[model samples]
Target: MTDFDATAYLPDDLLERIRSRAAAVDAENRFPTEDLAELTAAGYLSILVPTALGGAGLGLAEAAVLQQRLAGAAPATALAINMHLVWTGVAKVMSDRGIDDLRFVQTGAVAGEVFAFGISEAGNDLVLFGSDTQAVPAADGSYSFTGTKIFTSLGPVWTQLGLHGLDTTDPADPKMVYAFVQRTDAVETRDDWDTVGMRGTQSRTTVLNGAVAPADRVVRRVAPGPNPDPIVFGIFSVFEVLLASVYTGVARRALDLAVAAAKTRTSKKTGRPYSDDPDIRWRVAEMALAYDGLLPQVAAIAHDVDVLVDHGGQWFPRLSGLKHRAVVAAKQIVDDAMLVAGGSSYFQRNELSRLYRDVLAGMFHPSDPESAHATVAAAWLGPVGG
Candidate 1:
């Protein structure tokens, strides 16, 4: 708990306010505007920016801790904010490695600019390596992205979108263009974000009809597939760790709720609290064991990223594995908590019910189970055909 203390960055009163709004945000399928305001005012959005740039100047280790705490109170709000943090975190990574390419991202974040991640596309299994969206290079070295990006969190309020697309106009030297586009008339947001859980995120579909990212905003132009580029490493490391932190927070809340329920609810036949029941005690213990294992793994990986521990090629596998474990464990913990709470938790209004839906969204994020397994297997046993 000491390692994950969120109060050091976020006050108890702020968390209470966020927690109080969770039910409403989820129920109404509305964005947590107030939560965003408070978090912004408290400088939560700039946690990863450098202190020299007027930010909290914290590393991924501290950011992970705060993310877990924030999600425990409001999962959707945290998830929405995660998109913004990803850009700043990536900027931090680049800066640490002597690359000043993303300093604009860091400065913009501190200036109250919300950066939405718009990399996810429909039927694009290649993830970071390839993009279905097209990045057509223009006369002035700028690029116009024209394709559909799905699951764009902060869709309603983002000032800029950090996205990537395939540039194949020059077939001889096709590249993946990574860039940021400011909100403009060319960008269209489709109001189609209703989902089973994490509803407050309002992660709608974004259709880019030649949305332009000026030459200066153009960040990288690497090959379509994997390379040792610092930007690639920065995106993967920060995204996976922060994502894992959010779901881990969800698991922690579920475990705590289960324990409270077990201690308060009495069994009719035994005329005693369910806490006295051996079966209930065992279930709670199981939940605790799963949650306890994830916390240290999250902390360790985040710490490694902070200290620049060179795991070499093993970094992706380690990062993906940690995310996979945290998400899977969180889902399992929520399922157990629902059972411990009995039929009351089956209600739509129940917090456990909301968590059940929210946790499921974890499976859909990047570094998914299949990809994580593939990455780890490749790391240990070599490529599938090799």
Candidate 2:
């Protein structure tokens, strides 16, 4: 626990401030600009970058703990910031294993440059395996990316976007280019992020009209589809674990609120606090059981990633499974908490109601329930009909 103290990174005062603003941010459907500014000034953005590069020099496990704490206060802020952290985490993972390819990413983060993940597309279910975006090579070795990206978190504030595209012009090699493009006139950010939950994220659609990534900035050109490239592992590991951390934090908060309500709210039937009601106590206990189960699993997987413990081909299944369970558990915990809190939590102004909506967003993230089950099944049963 000493290695990863959530409070050490996000103290009470900062969390309270973030929590106080969560409602307004969600109600307005605006980005938590103040939250990001405070976090950046506090060096939260560079948690995964090495100390040599002026960062906190932390690892994925520590980042996970911090992310959980952040989410407890502001799920939208935490989720939006996750896109930036994912790049820095990948840089840390690669650097630890002697790959300096992502050194620039670490340095950029330390310099206060925000990097957003732009891999998710409209219908690209292949995830990182392939890309519908076009990567056309230029005379100077740079590539111009032309395509539309969806759910691009940090879209408005990101100075750099980490994305992937297919370079089919070279029919022989057909490489999938993974690179980062700085914000430019060519990159268009649409004002269309009005969602039911996590409204503060402002995750808008981005149209890349030949957005350019200079030659030196282009990181990888591996063949498309499932490959053993370190970059892929780094991305998948960091993304899934950090994403899970956010929802787990949400569950923790929901459980805390339910317990508090049980102690304060009186039961009409017995004229005693709801805490004295057997049904209320049982529901809270169920929430605690589920919430407690997720913490250790998230910590263990994140620690394994930090220590470079190779799970081989099983890594995807494990990562996806953890994410899937965390989301499902968080959703269930929130639902139970709503019942425990009774009709009071049904109000739009109530924090639990906000959390209930935010937790629903977990289902839409990558390695979703359907995909996670397919992955775990494939790991045990092999390919379908093989």
Report the number of the highest-TM-score candidate: 2
Clashing pairs in 2: none
Taking the tens digit of each residue's C-alpha lDDT, what string does model 1 give over 71-100? 999999999999999999999998998999
Clashing pairs in 1: none
Score every model by TM-score: 0.98, 0.99
lDDT over C-alpha atoms for residue 258 of model 1? 94
Clashes of 2: 0
Error of 2 at 28 (Å): 0.6
Off by over 4 Å in 2: none
Say what the RMSD of model 2 is: 0.9
Candidate 1's displacement at residue 95, Å, is: 0.4
